[model samples]
Target: MSKGENTRKRIIAKSAELFNQKGYASSSLSDITELTGIKKGGIYRHFASKDEIAVEAYKYAGSIVSGKIHEALDRETTATGKLLVFLKVYENVVEAPPFIGGCPLLNLATESDDGDPVLRENARRGLDNTLELMKRIITEGVRSGEFKADLDVDALATFALSIMEGGIMLSKLDGDNRHVRSNIDSLTAYLKTVAAAS
Candidate 1:
């Protein structure tokens, strides 16, 4: 990559980490500059304002989750296997420090709603993207004969997304992963029943 491209990436990466760790409202431009070792003027060269950086960072985090989910789905051939893998991946995410910050969309939604339009829009898009991905996976499962023909892919996708985000929020609130893990276990079991009925 060119020097400019690398610098932009560095700023985004650092901003993502800071936002995840301290939240968008709490993280300051100085914090980003200090962490990235890039001057404030340099940051402005890449992003017009802190809100812009926050929006980009939010997208960056959501893309990370999408990539991980896609990878898990790609690991198995059958729809049932893919669903199982996806649930298991969430279980594993509970054990990872990175996810300890919780879902970026959930975080941003809680903080940005009624406050910042850009941040709210970013969170909304992240959630919409997640729901779309789940819908696609459920559709695949149906085509593969791993899901019942009567299944409501849209509802299931929304429910799955809600459960995952809800579980993460509960985990963060309770300061324990047990609740999240249990919810995930239940989700997996539920997915198995749906797959078996196909």
Candidate 2:
């Protein structure tokens, strides 16, 4: 890649960590500059504004998370297996978070909900993307006869997302991975009951 392109990506990657570690409102340009070792003018050269950087950085982090989920999905053949594996990804959040801070989706949503207009929308979109993925998995499970056909896909996905996110938040706050791991186990057990038998 060209020098300019590399710089842009570095800015995004570094800023993503900064924003996720601190927050959109809490992170400053100087903090970004210190983290990236790039001058303020250099950063401005690549991003028109800090908001632009935040939006792009968020997209960058989101892409990494989405890629991780897709890469690990091939191990499961059944729809329910795929969903469980997907949820298990969160089990590692406490030990090995996708980002420096934690789950970017959760962090961004909690902090940016009423902050920056553009950032708030970006966080909302990130949330929607996750929910849509869960919904898609549940829908496929129902169609494949792995999940009960009569189950409410929307509600199920929402419940699973809520449980996982809540567990993650609690674990992060308490400095314990047990909370998330237990939630994953509980979710797996619950889904198994709803899954169809051989």
Best by lDDT: 2
lDDT of 1 by residue, 38-131 (tens): 9999999999999999988888876776677777778778765665454455564445734436577788999998999888888888777777
State every prediction's TM-score relative to the real structure.
Answer: 0.88, 0.95
Best TM-score among the predictions, by candidate number: 2
Evaluate model 1: give its TM-score. Answer: 0.88
Candidate 2 colliding pairs:
none
Error of 2 at 9 (Å): 0.6
Candidate 2 vs. true structure, TM-score = 0.95
Specify the poorest-scoring 10-residue window by lDDT in model 2.
79-88
